[model samples]
Target chain A: MSNLLTYISVNDGKIKRSSLEVLSRCNEIAEKNGKTSSAIVISDDCSTIVENLKSYGPSVIYTIEDPIFKNHLNTPLLKALTLAMSEINPDVMAFASTEGSKDILGALAANRNAAALADVSEFDWTGDAVTAKRPVMASKIISSVETKGSPVILTVRSGSYDTVEKSGESKVQSIPFTFDKNELKLTLKEIISATGDKVDLSEAETVIAAGRGVKDEEGRKLIDELAAVLNAGIGASRALTESGDYDPSLQIGQTGKVVSPQLYIAVGISGAIQHVAGMANSKVIVAINKDPDAPIFEIADYGLVGDLYKILPPFIDELKKIKG
Target chain B: MKFYVCIKQVPDVNAPLQIKEGELIQDANRNILNAYDASAVEEALVLKEAHGGEIEVVLIGPDKASETIRKALAMGADSGSHILTEGSEEFDSFSYAKILAEFFKDKEYQYIFCGKQSQDTDSGLTGSMLAEFLDLPYATNAVGLQLEGENLIVKRQGDTGQEMIELPAPSLVTCSNDMNDPRIPSLKGIMQSKRKPVNTIAVSDLKNGLTNGSIKTSVVGYEEKPKREPGKKYEGEPDEIAKEVAQLLDSAENVI
Candidate 1:
């Protein structure tokens, strides 16, 4: 039986839930195939993350700790991943499709001379190759792709699977890694975080996305209040983000973050296909727009024809009442 | 500083698409420069405008893809390189990266830029793959770019925030379409693009050209995504519908 390795993505010392989701899927695949499921974490200190990963049930946890991994630098991270691939010689290496993982996925695949697949929604191991289904043409269609090689690299989109908790006596091994400063060809200046301490959009169960209808401070205040009431992450459409009303990081569309939260509330969004591609996978979609013929209504589970400014205040109050 | 932006011509995603016998068919005339690559070209032009330098765009496609190159040149790039390939070749990201590496092996440039991903495929692998093949420092999903004394400061959108990264010259970066609005070519600019220099080279002419064996991945087939049917529409008073839906979210949907 071959080995399946999941790269556990850690940001700010906290393990990403999406990584665990991938691990969960891998664990199932390993069990079905009678193979080994493993996980690798590359960060400054892996102890805490390792402890957290135990619940996800990877048989082997590989840790490569280095100070250089404190920030998302492609060079050192790629080296560490290549080293891990060589050390483990896994049949398939999977990753959660985060920005950090996306930064290094291709480089690592190239370095290892392995076949790579990005942003797959569904995947399974077939005899010697890995077959996956990924969204193409801006999520308008799904393409079934096959990667024929050993040590296939894959990055799975978030919310594709459910995270299952299966505690086991997992073995943790620390891989030896050291980086020379001269090899580091890039410098991380600083991170500009607009939504500080807010819930991560991709991970949150509920997301409140503002659009062009969220024009001014008053509309933004309503969105904030609604998000606060629901304890949801705040997102924005390209219109709002491009107009400087929201941070670019908050943009939800084909060009920005793809979110599949349990509940998504679109405020004033026209439901452009590009925008819909990012959140169509959301379990329950709620749209509030003035236009009755908006395309978003075609996909929204619950479409309310009204101005967001008027709808949000009462909606927030009702949610607060229910939450209390 | 000399900048090279890699572009691709992709079928317009907005255009109507049909799946016949598990193959996707699109209108041939609807092909356009990938939006993300257009942003890269725009960024290159902005950089060249600020700093005295030349911006050249490189594209790998069929002969007809030259129109995409002209589109970039109309956006203020100095020249173009059309790496011609047969329209029927089934090449994956690896093969593309290998061919681009060969083309740039002997070339000189301070920076190479590409779209974060193609609009049609959305693989998002070629830029970083090319970087690894050429052994260059690189970043992806850059929302903003700037030039320091000798380094390029890239503001990339990460999972949590916008990361400001600085890289030395001769690096590669994959740009996001969120950076800037690509300019619509003016009549005069389109006229000038006709006279601009574009060096076309066949894929077979590369030092070590691509072979079918180099492609490790292939699309087995295509299918329409499962459609999410619209549920219910409530057109009533704002407060009535808002409160009604909020209550339903708790009692009916159980999501609250």
Candidate 2:
């Protein structure tokens, strides 16, 4: 059919936030194109994984498996996607802009000589083309793109668009495809994991981030207590993380993790542009800096001028009270 | 061993970079190599030095991108080639990489090196995408890379931590800032760069049937980043300030 839309999904390590966002956008686009959207996942088996993602409103789920696919290597995924796109010949192909997906999809688009739009934060279905917003120049500008090629390949920026929720029934099928694992250039011999039990900041919704303002473990404990009360995740600025005061997993800045949280509480962090760009999309922002003029306040919906130590105690006490 | 590294010229990252009145204001006067691309070039240079081989620096972008190539040659690349594209400056990584794949398909370079991702977009897609197009083994965010006969020993970073991977030759590797220290252009190299062979080819030469993407992703407009509020020193005692801070979190700070 001229209007079948395909969603290219990559599942590696933990499923990414961006993948859901892509499926959401595809659903919107497919409606406009007069066809239904389906998910294409490349993995070792379609049994359990495809069933899990079928809830995202795809009419059918296409899968190609190999033991090598378990690592979600980029080149193999690209090859698998290229083969799938040709077979399905969907009018639109979509994916999320996570690390592996970006690379795999971009390269796939290039090799096939197809058009690709990426890091799109928003999109509108027009008469003949889809309008997409890709932020550039350090998030200072937005590029509005209208696609002009067959099966336009697009990668959605993570956390920029809300994932769709299904209240109605959705059709689901499993289609098998040929995945030539031998064609991949790089192979993953081992998967080394991170140490300890710190949380991944990028995946957290409510984040309690501290900067250089916490001078000692005593001050850090207050922030920790506040975090525990709210069941929130903890993050730190570059200064504190580099100072060896906090775990690297807690670092949030340009060179650190990018997070999109529902509520972002900054303690003692003067929002540097590099740092702010990483987390400016938080639903609600709170900045606490002794210096009233800290840059972090520019994007913060709320600002506080006081020492974090004394303020944190009563705040935690009240949160605990609510929890109790 | 032969290495081909991709390089691009970009505006100084912190020169009041802004989108004003629908124009990207890059002080054309001050330009350094793209930070990530520079890392790519640096990684290439390191390979040439350690393994004793030839290094060719390749760049595809606007005409001014030649200046960036000159800087790379001056930094000790054996030579340089330019894949010129009209209005290529406005092209995204998709178009850039497409044009590059066209230029590279015929050449048989043993290894390709690039930054893990360009800093400007932070997309981290170009290198991996390039590997896919070429159907080569690719490793990214590599902090440590060593040559092993026809194989590669690479220390790569992931969401969790570093991984040691072994891949076949003819691979694509992108470096993080940790890979190795990039060398600065020595004075003698700068003087010699003036005479180094710099060749330019029109976009038509590489014409991998690439056109500015049909999708007209245009900019609505841009505004300068808002300046931060100056910190206000609370004169109250530590206890008072702490109380105020807690109150501020729910009210002004909006966190509690």
Candidate 3:
């Protein structure tokens, strides 16, 4: 039987839910096709991660434990992944599309001389080739892509598949790995984390994004208050982020993060195609814009035409009441 | 110091497009330099202005994409190289990266810059793939870049935060459009851009293993994304509508 491998991504001592989603999908595909599904976790210590991955229903779990993986560095991470590939030699390797994965997806593909597809919304193994649907043209169109060859490397977009929990015992295999600092080509000086302890925008269930219409501190305060009420992550459009009203990391658009939250509230956003490209997949979209003809309303499930200044206070109050 | 910024000409996403029998058709006149590549070019220009270096923008596209190279020169690049490709070739990121690696095999440069991803396809794979092919150190999704002696400090947007990475000379970096605003070409600058040298090389001239048979991935077709139908619009009486929508979200949507 062919092997399907999922790379489990760990950040801040926790397994990313998106990776679990990809693993679940791989497990399902393996079960249907009679392929052996496995998972690989690369980190400083893979013990905890391996223990957590058992519920995802992988037949085998591979762990590469090294101190070099404490932070995100492409050089050592690529080396570890390349080594793992040689040992397992899977037919298909999948990853969750994250900044960390994006950094190395192409390099890993090139390293193994394997076919690579990035940011696919949906993918399936065709026994001989892997077929996927990728969002192209600023996510306005879906492109059907097929990669023919062994060990096809692909990254799945977050929230593309549901994470299914299957309790079962899994075979754990620890892969030996090592790295020398002298071989490192780049040094990670530090991480300037702006979203410290806050909800990650991509993983958040609810996201409240501000835009140009959020003129000043008062408008930002309203966004903050509303997000606080809903316990949602706060994001910003390119306009607001470029204007220094929000951190660059929080920009939600074509040039920034693509998020598919359960509930997305776009306040004062004009819903430019770039902005819409990032959040169009949100389960429920609410657009609050003063202009009744704002393009955001075209796709928003609930379009509120009025001043965000006036709309936010009552919205926050009502949400608070409902929670109470 | 010398910088090579890789650029691409892509259809303006804002423009109207059509899909006929799985083929994507765009208005030819609306083609522009990819925005993220423009940022890379802009950052190269800024570094050249301060550190005193040469900026050469390289593009691999059809003959029509020459205008995009000229656009970069007009913005203050010293020269350009156009690796010409026939407009009809269906190349994925791997093909492009393979071709670029072949071109750079003999060239020497302190840094190579590219957009984190293309605007139209958004594959976001070519930069790192090219780096791997060249066996060079590289960083991607750089939102801020600074030069410290012979080292390049890249502030890249990570999954949860911004990572400050330091790479030595002769490395590659993929820039985000958030880095800087690309300068608009002035009238005089545009005129002078015509005088700047742009070396054109046909893709077939490179005698590598590059051929249609070598391509492993293909975009078979394209279809429209399932549309999200507009639900309800609430206008007038901001307080009432706001509260009404909030209640509905909790009760009807059950999302709260």
Best by DockQ: 3
Residues A1-324 of candidate 1: C-alpha lDDT, one tens digit per residue: 589999998867899999999999999998888889999999998998999888887899999999988888888988898999998999999999988888988888888988999999999984478999999998999999998777799999999999999978899999999999998888888988787889889899999999988889999999888888888999999999888899888999888888999999999999998999899999999999999999999999999998888888888889989999
What local lDDT does model 2 show for residue B113? 85
- What is the TM-score of chain A, computed separately for every candidate? 0.98, 0.84, 0.98
Task: Give the 10-residue window scoring lowest on summed lDDT in candidate 3 chain B.
Answer: B205-214
- Please say which candidate is ahead in TM-score: 2 or 3: 3
Which stretches of model 1 miss by more than 4 angstroms? B207-212
Docking quality tier of model 1:
high
Q: Write the per-residue lDDT of candidate 2 for residues A1-324, one digit (tens) a residue.
A: 554454544434345566777777777767776666777766776566655676676776776666757664665666677777777776667776554554465567766666667666776554356667765555554555566656567777667777785434555444455556566556666666553355545666689999988899898998888777766878888788667687554567655566788788898898876677668777777777788678776677666666777667765775565455
Question: Model 1: how large is the Cα RMSD against the reference?
Answer: 1.2
For all predicted structures, in order, the TM-scores are: 0.98, 0.84, 0.98
Q: For candidate 1, give the lDDT of residue B237.
A: 93
Question: For residues B42-161, could you state the per-residue lDDT of candidate 3 as single tens digits?
Answer: 999989888999999999999999999999999989999999988677677888899999999999899999999999999899999999999999999999999999899999999888
Docking class of 3: high
TM-score result, candidate 3: 0.98
Predicted model with the maximum lDDT? 3
User: lDDT for each of the candidates?
Assistant: 0.91, 0.68, 0.92
Q: Between the candidate structures 2 and 3, which one is better when assessed by lDDT?
A: 3
